[model samples]
Target: MIDIPDSDRQLIDQAIFLPMLLTVLQRDLAAIDKGSFKLKQPYQISIEAIIRDVQKDLAAAKRYLHKNNIKIIRGRSENNFTFYMVMYKGGEEKRSYFNDKIRNNVEDLLDYYLVGRQEER
Candidate 1:
């Protein structure tokens, strides 16, 4: 087992889950983007506020992960190794298929930080 601080688990959870929030937000944002003619100004403002909050949480999580050197890429550290392995190693065939797919998904989450994008609260 990889050795990591308990606080790191919280960080890891943030890293993994926050982008999920972004995905939902982005989905709704897309709808708003397309239906801009239909949505009222106040509704758009509310959605933008939610996006800002998600982005703030995303930035904080990314800062913690970066400060700790826990990269989101595979083979970079024990954290990445565990994350990729736990996800990819369910079966032999499963491992071979997702080298890029799974890693890319994580990269997409990281991209949210780059572009600006969770949290339970």
Candidate 2:
């Protein structure tokens, strides 16, 4: 097992999950655009704001990964677990995460971007 530093691990996690979060937000925005709603503007504006915030973070994560020569790849899934391969600093490590854990983490991130962080400002 290759040991990963906490900072790199955080960046790797962001690199893996931020794009997925963006995809979900984009799809949600598209659905809102297509659906008939009396007040779509508010929802659209909120989602757009969240998308911009996520994009900025994602860009930073990508830059960190590139500058540090780190790469992460999604591997095959088996049952309730999905595999990920991380290539960092001339070493490789395989990590497996439960599907539900990933979903929950993403949900938490969405909540933070949508509401939690907003309250801090």
Candidate 3:
């Protein structure tokens, strides 16, 4: 079984999850480009522009490693399966769930926009 320390989980979330989110945004942008032919005139440009801005933000996140610089180390098990661990700087090397709170906030924003949940009036 693969086990990740809590500290590493935060770094993993940044190094892996941000890129995954960017990939999703890119896919959405591609679909928008492909389907623009059917979108109404007034909404097409605005929607594409918004998506482009989000892509930019994700790109920025990928580059913002000035403090908690992250790296992944890999090792081979006796059975030959490769395992990876995340390492980072600028914090204690202990398990803490504080990053989970931050991740939840980010997820809430994503759910609000991408998942389109609405509040009752």
Candidate 4:
């Protein structure tokens, strides 16, 4: 059962969220923290360049975190998964979906959620 949050579902169609998620995933994956427990960390990340990349594309992931600073942490997970922690001085935000499935669900969920909402009205 893949349960996607409604907010995320809405964002998928906004022409901003899906790309935002991918850019973030790509950016974060490029640079895994040094002390991270995962050897090879099951993922890769590059923090700085991503911010620069975002300027070209609004969905560069770090847009929201602009100058706020973003951090990634690999947590303890049994599966081949790398946990991501997006934080700032205020605290960390909440994410309903973290796995690759979130990316996959982008188009489908966007079509379903947005189109469906239109039909409902």
TM-score: which candidate is best?
A: 2
Question: Local error of candidate 1 at 17, Å?
Answer: 2.0
lDDT of 3 by residue, 74-118 (tens): 434334233445455533232233445545645654564354533
lDDT (Cα, tens digit) per residue for candidate 1, span 24-90? 6677667777784764676567667766766787799789767656655323334333333212112
- Model 4 poorest 10 in a row by lDDT: 7-16
- Scored against the true structure, residue 120 in model 3 reaches a CA lDDT of 19
Angstrom error at residue 44, model 2? 0.3
| Model 4, span 1-121: residue lDDT tens | 2344554334323333445444654545554554465565343333343333434444434443454354433344335443444343545643344446545665454454335534766
- Pairs in clash, predicted candidate 4: 28-45, 29-44, 29-45, 30-44, 30-45, 30-46, 31-45, 31-46
Give the TM-score of each candidate: 0.51, 0.93, 0.42, 0.29
Give the candidates in order of TM-score, highest first: 2, 1, 3, 4
Sort the candidates on lDDT, descending order.
2, 1, 3, 4
With a 3 Å backbone cut-off (N, CA, C), the pairs that clash in candidate 2 are: none
In model 3, where do residues sit more than 4 Å from their true spots?
1-11, 40-64, 73-83, 89-121
- Candidate 4 shows a clash count of 8
Better of 1 and 3 by TM-score: 1
Cand. 4 TM to true fold: 0.29
* Best candidate according to lDDT: 2
**Per-residue C-alpha lDDT of model 2 across residues 1-121, encoded as one tens digit per residue:** 6888999999899888888899999999999999999999999999999999999999999999999999988999999999999998999999998999999878888999988989989
Q: By TM-score, is 1 or 4 better?
A: 1
Cα error, candidate 3, residue 97 (Å)? 17
Model 3: residue 18 alpha-carbon error in angstroms: 1.7
CA RMSD per model (angstroms): 9.8, 1.1, 8.3, 13.8
